[model samples]
Target: MRIAHATAATAAAALLTLLGTAPPATATTRPAGPPATTARPPAPIAWGSCPDSTADTRQQCATLAVPLDHADPTGPQLDLAVSRITAARPDQRRGALLIVPGGPGNPGLNGPTNAVRRLPRSVLDRYDLIGFDPRGVGRSSPVDCGLAHDDLSMTTLLPWPAPDGSVTGNLAAARRIADACTRNGGPVLRSISTRNEARDMDRIRQALGERRISAWGVSYGTYAGAVYATMYPDRTDRIVLDSNDDPDPSRVERGWLAAYATGAEDRFPDFAAWAAAPAAGDQRLADTPQQVRDLFLRLAARLDTAPLPWPGANPARLDGNALRAAMLDTLYDDARFPRLARLMLAADGRAELPPAATPPDAAMQNTVAASAATMCNDVRWPRSADGYARAVAADRTAHPLTAGMPVNVMPCAFWPTDPAEPPTRITPDGPSNILMVQNLRDPATPYAGALRLRAALGDRARLVSVDSGGHDAYAAHGNACGDRLVTRFLVDGRRPAHDTLCPAEH
Candidate 1:
């Protein structure tokens, strides 16, 4: 769910949506460590005023310098922009609770401000909410690949194949991006990876002077959290991993991307049902769910053959791949159903097309660069173009909704650097303080994947699966039961004795 999803209308507004707006990545299985550093007592932060964009007046900001490479701590340093809103009831304060954002590239400095609005007063009063931008992201020593603007688009970055399921263009793009990142992205970009992010987190913990830190990591953050908890097991107080990625160490990022195929299949029924409802009126695609599915498939295939001119869009056309991309993005949330419905209507010649949407070129460049680094560096990907073409061809037939993009080639196939360390394997070796919240039908990180993470954690974690269809399950989705379970766990340190399921809201 951490994978950023942008609509044609609001893609330019911001990089982060609800849980997050970028693709997700899984954690590794080996103990690649800079050696746990719980004994390093660091200096106190020099808190200062936050940016003008900060909405919460209580939020304070600061910077913590971490090594560009953890192995050599005294090497060049990178400043992480950190933010915090101290507990409202200092008397009731227990410890700090970090709000981990979803993307490997998503900025976390604004997370505390956003959490202040969503978190309950009881939880807010009991812990100081902390947030920070991971290395190579935002104000934390940002890195860019200086990619051509065309390569920055979600459609391209996501690796959607051609109408014929040919990966020829995708392979070319992978080489181009990889070469550019190596040419323009300096050491910082090369240093970006899931394990490194986990190291930076421990550095943040040391700087905070906390013996143990509690965290609520969502989407891509869940993998980061899993790695951190594994690396510094004893230093974790309370952990909540939401919308988890599959921790298939053998596959890592490849597994995460391939998950979209299953996730789309799991979640599409919800969209079909919604689109077929009588309330849909003019926007309704069909009278039944099956009919809606048929209609969408046919429409997309037709668009493949004859794309309509879309002046402001990246490719300046409403091609079948664009429709498919929008479908994947809209499937993340039910609230976005109408956007897809409207687009379908326009594509069907029943309504006018909406304006094109895309995130700022510079912002996407930074995000794509960091995201690609994290995935490519986490674990090696298959490098054969013919191998990828074969996989794409098979996936296209197996999962038409995704059109083989999930298994398509990416810049990682041509990455310039190898992973500095093995992906941290999530084991049952951590404390039993971790609690996970997941939606049964998450389009980004599916419930099946969450189960994998839960199994990996074993007795160290508990899961509260909510009967919902969306990306994030905790505070964003309106499931009071799931919310109460997570809130109680965070506020009082009480969790279900066993895995529990929260049924859908009536």
Candidate 2:
């Protein structure tokens, strides 16, 4: 699987335990409009054969010119790379179904190609699948912070404090990263906010000549899709938000960051149970779930003081924070269970260190910068290091598995620029056209957070909860029942009469 942006992983944890009650309602008023752009409507996209590296021959590629800053659309322009696969049965075409990728930084250029293989044939036959790389990402006008190689490491990007829970080093790292972005990232980096992404989506719709468009938005894209639906209610058709995020306007990305503590807590049990099962063979950590948890905790604590050298891994060591971060990443999918299991085995002297997987340096630089730009630009983080220190200490005490990384200081704490506009509040006033599919035990976007999103949408949405663990529910790590609900909704405009739950997949 593709590695998510480093900040994406750090931002996954929550500060508080999973609360049964939903977050209280916030203001319903929409934020002020962006500065008017040039009156010129973009010309229709000129489709061409995709690049040689593109795996799917059916997928055609195109590009659209959008304003670097929507507030000043006439000032400077940026190119957004887009891709599409026409409906298999054009006679029955419903409209374009845009795939909004998860990371604020992930490239969506292959979304259409990837979806065609997973979605039901009926849905594929009915809608043109569309995808795009948002501004300042991938084939779009990319942004780079020009960070040093070490700065690109996930451990550094996540602000993992010292084993003793000190933020001294974390604070300095945050400052260094923030400084690097300010120095190397240009105006394009500043333009990479969620609001701009939503605007870019609208621009894509206009370019496609579609009055309304459908969407399948996952992870952070769910938040962007929610903002788009709220801002342009009439322009949305069927909307599917998989692995939803809480749309708390007051907290926004910070809320996402804080969710990791609860998310890890909720998900760890599944991993524990799997690791202890007899069927796990040589990978079994213990005979019982509780034992597995204890073993993991003990091993992590030991690593805190005496990290083992790992030749191929970033930072070249297996320390407490690295182990914790690895656990967080592996929890996203059951398929990755062996990764954590092997790490545990190595820690216990039962196995050797596995080959480390790393992304290209250029890719990491772009993703990190884009992720930081969107998150830091979307909202203002607390400027006081002391505040983050306190929160991290509290989080570490409450959720030891995450080691306070969720609430710890990040580059955003020292971001040079404030959000251009307030975060958009998701209200229930939009058209009742959204269907959310989520896994009950998702590590990144947990069920508790998904509940907050469900509550926020109110009458505007229906939810299909899958009794499973992992992220990106519909047709991905979700059971047939949940997948059927989402596919039915997208293909036939049918949703459950009310919120529904699917039994766990056997």
Model 2 regions lying over 4 Å from their true place = 1-31, 34-38
lDDT of 2 by residue, 95-213 (tens): 99999987767778988988988898999999999999888888899988888778777787777889888999878777888888888888888677788899999999999999999
What range of 10 consecutive residues in model 1 has the weakest lDDT sum? 13-22
lDDT of 1 by residue, 287-329 (tens): 8999988888898999999999987778889999889888888
Candidate 1 clash pair list = 2-22, 3-21, 3-22, 3-23, 4-21, 4-22, 28-424, 29-425
- TM-score per candidate, chains pooled: 0.94, 0.94
Superposed Cα deviation of residue 380, candidate 1 (Å): 0.4
Could you give me the TM-score of model 2 versus the true structure?
0.94
Model 1 CA deviation exceeding 4 Å by range? 4-31, 36-40
Each prediction's whole-model lDDT (CA): 0.81, 0.81
